[model samples]
Target: MPATPGAFLGGVVVSCAVVGAFEAGARPGGSAWPARARRTELCRARQRAGSGSAEPCNPFIEENELTDVGLGGLMKPLKRLLSALTGPIPVTRSRAIGVSERLSAVTTLTASLEYLNQRKQTQPGGLNHWPTARGVHGRSTPVTRKLLDIISEEKTTLTLHAARAVVSAGMLLPGSSRWRGAGNIFLGATTAALHPRHRYGTDGSDQVSILVQTATGLARFSARPQTQDALMWYVALQANASYFVSGWVKLMGKAWKDATALGGVMRTKTYGHQPIYELTQKYPRVAKYLTHGVLALECFFPVVYLAGGRLARPMIASAATFHLANGLVMGLGRFVTAFTSMHPMVAYTSAPRTHPSVAGRDDRVLQVGAVLLAGAASVAGVVAVQRRMRALEGWPHSRWLTTRHGNQLQYEMSEGDDESLPVLVFVTGLVSTSEHFGWITEKVARDSGYGVVTYARAGYAGSRRRSASSYHLAESVDDLVDLVRGVVPEGRTVVLVGHSLGGELARRAAVALGERLHSIIYLDSSHPGELNRSHQQSEATERIADGMNTLVRSLNVGLGILMAQPDWLEELPANCRTRVFAQYTDARFWAAGRREWAAVEEEFRAFDGKLPVVDSHALVISAQQTIDRDPEQLLMHNEIAEAHRGQGHSVEKVVLEGADHDSLLTGARFATEVGRRIIEFLDQAESHATSRVCVVEEVGQ
Candidate 1:
């Protein structure tokens, strides 16, 4: 549909009205809300909570925090005077562009100023120094690397900001129309730099500002009416996508559905408002209704185009109030202009094509098809790249075995130079891959001359369950038994090592392996009685369940790009890092995790605290945090060790310092230490066994 000039200008004016209201709400202290009173209340609340500090509760402020204030009182009268002076100004394409450009310019100017206020962070040894800043770029080409090096220099960055400030100032001038396009282009580049440099502090305002500036710059250069319409359509579509996608994603989260998301957010010191938090706590029902109201507005935001733009004003007004409220309560004041600036384009596009004043052919069919095609292409490209990255090399080569239950389990195995030594059969935890054991497995296989094997359980990684029915812990245990029996030679001794849920599987499998089992090592493993015994575990189970549910749904719908590469990537072998990350971002991995968790939660909830007592040497390696944070978990691990000791077996308990549950395996340092301890324990156990055999032989002679 063509963007009729009148419709475009009318939309821009309507957008200005919202901006006018936003300006009117500005106060002397730069917020419509009573900031002093809020702070006083926060201080009182903290004091009541037993904080005896003399000073008010002031945390470190971010760069965005410095510039999030509303328009000051000084500009209010001036804006009103200007409105009176230009009461009857005719709506035109140039005027609309001017208004949008100026709004975007103001946003960029304030952001650059805010960033400069925190300029120390851009210097060497600061949070945003080149070394730290460059990590977000991942693997870049040499040319791009050189460009990053140049732009990341403290002097260069500061100069760029200075230049951006000047460009923004020029954009604000009424007679800078000739240079508006170039100024916007420069501003877009500068705005784009802020995210990769200071990703932690920047918000939607920074992102929206970039989009506005770039689109406006491109629109300025395009003289064709059709091109202008297309640009406006692009902005409107993006605005709709931003809201709907956000709402839909949040809908997948259990917290949002249960209405606790807002309360949880407001309880944080970073973005919290004590009053609003208290209100949520005191009136949960009201909070629920309010949360759902937000979801309704966001999820159905595209309805603005319905009824030939009749609903546009009400929806835009609602959104304005929502942004304003967020500004007041969440201290995101700049969002008002950053987001609402796009409202003009939305309003313009919402106009009826059949209207007498408007000129357009309804080509929405082609637009929709084009959008779908682009989305599919993007998803396909992501899939192909991920597949390439996940390709593994040499040892731990992918292999599969079919189980009795018709499930196909994927495993990687390597027989180290020695065949006599008991194979170290590694079992991984739920939702985790065997690749996570890269560091420890390498250490054990190299130092101890023992064959190492790692396998993904059914429905995890390359493993697949034959049936879509409910998963059970017994089924996974059975699958492990099948994998071990299929891979290991008959009568070969096996040292079973398990982490978390894998430990439970190993324990059960030991009962089946009988005399073939040599030793058992549990690395911060799960206890059967955890859910029944510990209140904390039960609460965590609920949260984990909810999180898994959200993850499964989100990834299934191809939102895996939103997932970040975990910091633990460095813990694995260099060749395995990308493969592990690829697996993590794959939908099938999370789906398997969800299924496994459901079975685990169910089993744990019904657990009677019974576990098999294995008559073998046992080593219990517990992470320090596991013991420090949850004392019950320590007792449980000790209980596991004691059960083996009861069966006339030697047992050793060791705690690794500076390790957490996942980090015990995923942290290279901790994993190495774990491997060292395991080798030591194995040497002692074998030596003890050898001495006992010699004594028996001497007696027989």
Candidate 2:
């Protein structure tokens, strides 16, 4: 509605009159409030709380504190005017502008002094919190979550009664009742919430302890007023630290030194068109120095406060004033948010989830910052802690094997429903780790009474990478042979199990070991016929050469970078070997890993050498499901298994029906079935060995 002429004129006249009165009274000392009043009040507040009296249990202040301290950001501005005239403001400027702190502070002090003074006269030394007739109780911007809710839902008219809330700024002034009680209560609650670990844990933090300690001291001291001043000064220091830092960081930047550049940056996304930005533009040099100076003060103030003695109170009082000025000049939400963020002890009451600005900011920025902070700190902290615990429990580095390439290798061991026993040692496929086979490994251990061991090859998992020339089936066999010799050498033969590429490695290792091997289990290992059949070795060699070329590119410029752009390149892990790191870490290394297997398969099929004879019990556990739409791929698994089984070895075929290949080793289905078979095999093997030993003993007899 348009303003009525008479009414509008009346408002202008009143505004002029009010401003004149405020300006006059605010001239540093219309009455020049005695600093002693502040000190006396502090002492009285303690006395009022009878000696050993329990802390206040009022609910009004507790809930109101949240809004007052600043979390309810959107309501701050509307509340500011109310604070000025009614004295609801925090002590000092925050309270100085509001009638609240001054009113409370005075009432608390007067009541306490009267009680304590009377107690001294009557019985002396102690009159804990003076039983007072009780009572007590206690932002930011409009663009908050609260504002959005209001706008979207068409809530009440905000402009109507906003002015009615104003309180006297002077009420928070020294010698006022509000400042004594309200500020003290605020000081008490906030101190309780602060982190004890923070350096200045005592500054404003130990309010309860300070109060308790000060009570007896007050009675003894001739000047209790000075002590109160000191305490206020300390609390204020912690509250205003951010103003110094924000101004400092920005001012130190090169652009801030140059007026034009500083203005440009201010106009950039950093500050937008806020009043502070405008102020910055008008006084670049002054702003820069002031910002830099304040930051330096904030950075070091905590240290000074912690140093004890005369440094604490004075420094804190200065900081509080700086913050108050910042609050008055800038809007509430920013001040409230900033204050809470820096020193968490100062909780501000804010309108619930509302924006500080009119329309709110870009949601994308909020989401991104949230992710960045949470991921870098909270999420990472949890993950690192979990890993540490697992490591502490003796889960070794061998759990996740690294591939020749930088990437990790995980393979699920094969499990099939065969009640025979076997001591299964699982070898994972290329670029796979035993972690994937947790199900199958557990099954072998539990149901089969079988012991399973899986590990990464040399090049994978940050292990040293070997050259292409160094990675043939023989090299793979050698590694397995070494493991067997070292870890389980006494076991004449362990049921060796391999899946896919792992199977090929297992077979080669078995053949290399000769009579030392017991039985071999191949889980749909790669077949020679799946790849180029005609030109075998020569063609296979060429494929290796091409892979080496890709590996060269990866090694030269970090593999992930070879495939993508430079800036986007991930920092190669320091522990990774160059050769394997280049290829496997590329993420495209998978294709190369598969290609390497195919080449090996080609070489195996075209071999003219005679096959090794195995007299041990063999099990061919096949995955019954198809993962990809490949014609020859599905047939190779069966064809290879049939060929091995037909070689006159005591072979058992068990296809885990309707299961994915990855889960074959780790899933419950594989574990329950595969474990039972392996256990039986081990029992039979042990029985046979015992029988042979007995026969030898009989011969000796």
Which structure among the candidates has the greatest TM-score?
A: 1
Per-model TM-score, in order, reads: 0.73, 0.33
Q: Which lDDT tens digits does candidate 1 get at residues 562-652?
A: 6777777876789788778777877667777888888888888887876766777788888888778889998898888877864346678
Q: Give the alpha-carbon lDDT of every model.
A: 0.73, 0.41
- The residue-by-residue lDDT of candidate 2 on 290-334, one tens digit each, is 655555565665443231112333443345455445434422112
* Model 1, residue 644: C-alpha shift (Å): 3.7
Q: What is the lDDT of residue 246 in candidate 2?
A: 43
lDDT for position 191 in model 2: 26
Q: Which parts of model 2 are misplaced by more than 4 Å? A: 1-394, 397-423, 466-469, 532-615, 627-648, 680-701
